[model samples]
Target: MLRDSVTAASADRAARGRAARKRVPRSAHGTWIPAADRPDPVGLLQAQGRDRLPELLPVRYARMAASPLAFLRGGAAVMAADLAAQPHTGLTVQLCGDAHLLNFGLYAAPERPLLFDLNDFDETFPGPFEWDVKRLAASVAVAARENGHKEEHVFGAARAAAGQYREAVRRLARQGELTVWYQHIDADLLLPLVRSGRRRRRTEATLTRARRRTSLQALGKLTETVGGRRRIIHDPPLLEPAGAMDTASLRKIFSDYRSTLPEERRLLLDRYRFVDAARKVVGVGSVGVRCFIVLLSGRDADDPLFLQIKQAGPSVLEEHLPSGPYVHPGRRVVAGQRLMQAAGDAFLGWTTGPEGRAFYWRQLHDMKASADVAGMSPGELRAYARLCGTALARAHARSGDRVAIAAYLGGADTFERAVGDFALRYTERNADDHAALGAAVVAGVVPAAPGV
Candidate 1:
């Protein structure tokens, strides 16, 4: 009787949430107007560069200036500010914060099945759930445009993604909490959903490639024999040796990180001894950040482990949304990843770097593969967009009030079309922002290495 009463009260609250949010209406989310006090987009990019590694800022800008889609991927802060100014449902969730198309991927779970999910959580924090949906929908439009698709197709892709998200959320909301929590989309289950054609073949190939990306495979590709020892090969501007101090301080940092892991994981990690470390420039937005690849060896040179220690700064949403409870930004990322992902890296942990910067550690490229957006056909793009939407909804349902969100979306195309419209306009704005950044590069206002 008590359980029934509690369920009734919860349903009432969800119903109230739906009605309250409808006052703002889903269509209201379609508009985007720059505030008079809005920060200049290029200026915002420059502001972010201030605290990053000075030498690598040019590489970051060069990557962003390459294309409009690249610019969108790199400018999470710019988009965060824009989204914050737009109408929101006022429903908060732990967001990916940078949920662009490329961030969703295939990764192997500890149980060995390859699963598709959100693989990046750098900017994650509690924020308006629609912010992530907007970012994702906009990315689809931008990517479709970059692929030379017609404007109608671009908008169609965006609408399909939003529609999938709405439907997935509603479906998940009806399931029991344990069922929702344990749910995952594996490659076997996903491949059948795609029509049997070139798209299916492409996805199969990606899964095959991902399965080969184990620690052993990485050890062979990234290391070499040096003075009878296996050491990471240095490839400058992409991969290079961290200086002497890095070697000296890493022992302490590694110990501190091990302490953060659970006892079983700590015991598992104890077998490997740190061998060498390297500074690696990674991703569009993360190029200037302090990212390092640490090499560890177990019994022999053939048995190795690669851990990526990435610097964690404040979330892009931190300035616009309610502050999260975490004092350590690395812990914030780890916690968010654990809460959202069905399964996370076994070595996932956090520690302070030598210079007091908070950093999160995770296994580097453990059977991970991202979608080949550059090569996707119009049909494939639409299909991939829908998959991303479903994966995102699953992630959000794990943390957000799914019943309330499902109620707010209701059973209509209104929210989907509104999101599609927003995506179209934002893609145009992203192009303009890309042009502005490109001009800054040419004018030498922002230094850039064009081919890098």
Candidate 2:
């Protein structure tokens, strides 16, 4: 009787998913006509910068103006508004919110093997699952073009991403809840496909580099033996000493973040003693945000741990979608990351900082691995695109009604093909937006300092 009830519930959810097709047909997903009154993309970016450091706004523009892909990375707010304008599948899940090619990478939880998965979560929030998929597809299309892949390969890569996502979702929907819960993409899983000897060696080297990226490794690169003691190196405008007040504030908030961790982890953290802190600039989209690196010593001066504290603002999707369960943006990011990533950081925590800003903390590096999209060949790009799609599907399945979403996707290539079309169309729009930003920089409408 219990088994029968579970079956009945699944059937009902599947029916609801199918019913959604009538409201927004699969073909409808192919469209991307900007509304006649679409807001100017630059103006939208300017608005996003209002909360950022005014002195650093030019850096954001310069980074964004670097390429169409860079523009897309920093232009999540613009795309969020655009995606909100369209009809959705209404199949909700915790979204990566900015699921671009670069964002899906390899990293490991404390004392675990590396796994390739979604690593960025600053914009994470619950929303229609397709928003994440579409973002990934669009990014693949843009990167392929930037890499000089032909149009045929461009469409092929985009379609591969959508196709793998659909296939993975269908597979996950049939698995037991526990099976889905424990599923993870081993970072080495893609090795079987690298038939070329040289490429295989390069891939292995990349993985080895990722594994070596521990806190100890960070100690060497980010710190120096200053006046017979270790200190965070100062490289003004990028990395600088956090003034005395800021340093004290970070120390004060350490306890609050400690409270959010598991008891055992708290005991582990208590072993470390604060040493120094520094403000650091990071990422294309994340530039100008309040981010700091906290250095701590454990056991002895030789045993060091680095934790990054980044201010969390409302997600770009916040205005368009309903508010997420966590009111504190830092908590929302931490919670969303824990839910999506197969393995999580041992030190992941959140707290409110000076001026009531929400901030989240986690080990630096956290042992990250991201693809060099600029260096990938057409075939390499396609394979990586498919892997990202599968990772995204697994994350969505863990959080959403996988059976229903599988039903919505159906067993046809129709949706994937339509998404390919959407990718190309949106790529055109994205290129134009990128060009406008460049124009703004040239006309002095916006400040820009390239090569920073």
Candidate 3:
């Protein structure tokens, strides 16, 4: 019996070693990358992003790639794959998939406080937690470069980001239940926490700007005076003029989606009567896919609500993470989005449309806001990056094995160096992808109007 026990233990150890050995592929630095492969990280994402561009306005595409910085802003999908190939402690979590500098911002929580957490989770999934951190770090380095900061500052910010992630995870690992429950980052409390004078001014300015991004502002800009009435109009080949969706078809899709939601969510949605629905263009990377906004109004005209039904493609992180065969990619996206976001759109749902196209639906504008990284000064960038880092730690802590991660990170600078190295390399790769997209536009492969 003793010999048999010894043999079983030996076999288990051997199996674990073999699996680990198979998992760790070589990195860009020539070391074994235990998470995913090194090269071709951007292949699937680039293909998907390119296909989605025609849905964008001609002017929007030009504007999205107007500058290297702008181009970098639009290419989160491409950057994700590069970061996924690095060495990590194998701690999986529901990642934000595209947690760049621009993805963080203020939103109204159910409590009415200006709460901040990851806002976009379309590409989210259970994967190596470092992929999200690495993406955020690379964006900081690149955005810092765009703002004319020196390399040292960029590297410093990257290291600070990793340090915060490691420290936060370690702290969370040892925290009492109440301590973990009580933590939340309010934008109002941020100015005092940021030490840099330049950064403080930037944060103040950003806060002021975010306050200006109200529902009324969005309505004013997106809607127009049509036939002596204000309405959301579609501009052809650019903004799909509002009549794009057939009313019958929309109801059918929504009905199918309704069947997929939980009983409580389905009942909550009964309050919303879909008024007008139309397909619209949104972000640069997410262009070309079918995205529609459903206008919902209650008894009074003033009681208006909006919901966005977006098609969910295969995860950009799936190539890196373990996603057992999904019957519907939209379900995977909705699940990941729910896992990562502290508070999500109340009406979020998922359905597989015609031809097996996967899609997830949510509130179109539930008080969403984003950082204007283009306008931020260097100091502001650093402070904002730190905030992003801390928030990322919180998100990772929600679904990942924090204890094992903290143990692997154990007072060592591996988290810092590994991500910093990825940031530097991947930033260069971003520039290249941006250039390629620019060339494609120049070759007339894609269309965009001037001042876009």
Candidate number achieving the greatest lDDT relative to the actual structure: 2
Candidate RMSDs in order: 1.4, 1.1, 5.6
lDDT of 2 by residue, 243-346 (tens): 99999999999999999999999999999999999999889899889999999999998898999999999999999987679899999999999999998999
Q: Score residue 362 of candidate 2 by CA lDDT.
A: 92
- Considering lDDT, which of the candidate structures 1 and 3 is the better prediction for this target? 1
Off by over 4 Å in 1: 193-199
Off by over 4 Å in 2: none
Off by over 4 Å in 3: 1-46, 49-64, 84-88, 176-183, 193-221, 224-230, 236-238, 242-245, 260-265, 324-326, 445-450
Model 1 quality (TM-score): 0.97
Q: Write the per-residue lDDT of candidate 1 for residues 1-452, one digit (tens) a residue.
A: 99999799779858965974666688877776766788899999999988799999999999999999999999999999998876677787889999998899988888888899999999999987888998999999999999999888999999988999999999998898899999999866557656758877877888889999988999888889899888889898889898888777776799999998999999999999889999899999888999999999888778889999999999989998777989899999999999899888899999998778999999997899887788566777888899999999999999998888888988989998999999999998899999999999989999998677
Provide TM-scores for the models.
Answer: 0.97, 0.98, 0.82
Instruction: Give the candidates in order of TM-score, highest first.
Output: 2, 1, 3
**TM-score of the candidate numbered 2?**
0.98
